[model samples]
Target: MEDDNISDTDRALGFTIPARHARGRIVRLGPVLDTILAAHAYPPAIEALLAEALTLAALIGSTLKDAGGQLTLQAQTDGGVVKLLVCDYKGGELRGYVDFDAERLAAGPEQPSLFALFGAGYLAITFDQAATRERYQGIVPLDGDTLAQAAQNYFVQSEQIPTLVKLGIARRADGSHVAGGLFLQHLPEGEEGRERLHTRLDHPEWEHVAILGGTMGIDELADPVLSLETLIWRLFNEEDEVRLLSEVAMTRGCRCSPEYIAQVLGKFPVEEQRAMAGDDGMITVDCAFCAQKFPVAVTNVVL
Candidate 1:
């Protein structure tokens, strides 16, 4: 059943329907990246690197709810040559950082592959549960040519889930960046649900869904063609009925805060804190994601 508030067309992208409410999510990941990562002038290769991470993070985070569970996506390569972490909790808040050879920036986007930036790295996906349940973690080698393909490989090899992904990025006329993407997955249906995908698996149903999603171009993301309503309707018009649930609004948000920094500083022994503070008796914390620095006085520490 489609909620009266949601039109079938609108469910195409950028909102979360509760679990079982909807089977998949389509996302627009750019513009937000430019806002968060492009403020500082990074060379083109690094810029693209961050852009891909941001896009991947958005898609991964879309799977769960912000109220309790948060998804962390990590790409760590050899000897700190390339290490990036991007986390998007259920709340839509996101933060991430990229580390690579500054000289490599001159090497150009084509020269450095995502893996080259961080050689011999692995991709890790972790689900953090708030309810005292165990956190779940999965790892896959970074093997694919593009981030999307790498993630797709991660699904097949690590999780054994059949998934398809399409990612497109573009720069806006005003210089902001925008990225658009789609994800389609076929899972074992319930006795009845499984009966459906299975019955249709041999048929053209899965292919039909993938083909429509792949057609969406950069323009659809930069500026949506139809509201989320019409888009979903048009895509699933073939189904007996597609159910659209409550809308979840998403935006660019960072979870970093002063108290969070204090906790990190507290992790060190009091003596180590004192030594790091030096004669000034202060410590500095810079957000890896946005590079914003927070300076705190030693006196502020209860220790």
Candidate 2:
């Protein structure tokens, strides 16, 4: 899709088709994806769900124009095996975690549908601007069997951009996990930045490209041997040209640290901090996203 250089792991590629008035993103997550999921010791079904959510986060998060901004995806259920799920991406740094009832999950089916797993839940996507501290969020129903379908609902309802999302995940013999996803949208028409989406959903160009995109199978996405460049070329080579943009590198990252934890703990009252300390006079704060613990001494920290 670009030059000879092509990334097969832990990268997101952005591209546009001028003639079709469309643009898309492709993400391949390897070691980083493995690291994020393995630390949780989740069941296979839970891990699969999180992998898709994390990959979806990366696909759309990388499109943020502001380098300092962040994208967060959260799913919540009132009565289901999984009570909560959250994932976020900033500057290509990815982290996610899920909270669930072990007993309930153990009794669940070998594979559960979205409604079966969540019962009644909603998925929220939030964009946080680091510079202006502005936050925009959109919430949609968890309708389809896959998270990819939920994302599509978001684009069609909130963004009003005709979109397609496909995700795949596979586990190797070594027990490591890999995930990949594609996000394609019809570029709106108008002046440079002021373009508006085609209110009528039946554009000829979008229909044609979306059909080609729909032909992609989920298995092809999770194939370790398949390069993202090869996949893009296979799908859109019939077009005049595909302009591939720079690739964004993704990695396992956590914002949790001793100093950061202490700063947050400082906001609590001194008596409350004392009650949280262990016999050793230290409070250990655990981060679910990274599976890391930070020890904060009440005496050392201003609480």
Candidate 3:
């Protein structure tokens, strides 16, 4: 019961269960994820962690109020394998990178839990909207077994909303990486609305949907052969109504450009810029997000 019409690449489907009063989002990342991860040669564990970060960013960023806004998810840790992992999302475009202690990663555990890999860290979500002068940020401790759990914790702690997230990452037979995720949130009803609906803050529908969502396997989540619609139906078709709201296309995009790089370099003193120049008398900078290198002439760097 798969949909033959839609491509199995980067896409997100937003849906809702009106009877259950729940909202959910499902995303599949194919070439978009492969391209982003292939830019850097990271260890398997580090790569998996980065994939989860990117998937979480996409699920949460799609909820941004402004179309021109960007959402960034960052994890800063004092662990052996990872120092920082950042993912940026804007208008369905996503990019991410990981910073790890090479020596530590080489000697670390073969397979560590998310908490072990990112020990004693904080997860921060920041919203940057072009229309607003001030950016908004929320920080929560990383105390979960997985990145999705951390995100769910954020919503429960910061927004006071009950949320659940399931994330999966795997390598295809061809050695490329792909990721998928499911996000569900219970819509809070106002006091009057709750009375009319006979729904309490701890509604039974939320637990019911979450229990059904827990049945999803990682393979089903990450498999390109499986259609998102099929997955949705399999999960919640038994409900009164499963409505598809919209679908968004995603791509591997980076915000870094030569002009932007030059502007950042301009902030430094000329002497400092000169000190950063290579033997060829040019300053080379590599974008942390995309790993794209931009070489600028030392003389062209305005002080």
Sort by lDDT, top down from the best: 2, 3, 1
Point to the candidate with the largest TM-score: 2
Tell me each candidate's TM-score: 0.80, 0.93, 0.89
Best by lDDT: 2
Error of 1 at 131 (Å): 1.9
Q: What are the runs in model 3 whose C-alpha is more than 4 Å off?
A: 3-7, 190-201, 267-281
Better TM-score candidate (1, 3): 3
- The alpha-carbon deviation from the true structure for residue 170 of candidate 2, after best TM-score superposition, in angstroms, is 1.0
Total clashing pairs for each candidate: 15, 0, 0
RMSD of 1: 5.5
Q: Report the lDDT tens digits of candidate 2 across residue range 1-303.
A: 344454378999998888887889999899999888878888888999999999999999999878999999999996878899999999999999999888988887989888878888999999999989999999998878889999999988887878899998888788877788999988646212223354445678889989999988777787767788888988999999899988899998789989889999999999999999999999999999988789999986774
Worst lDDT 10-window in candidate 1? 7-16
**Per-candidate RMSD, Å:** 5.5, 2.7, 3.4
> What TM value does model 2 have?
0.93
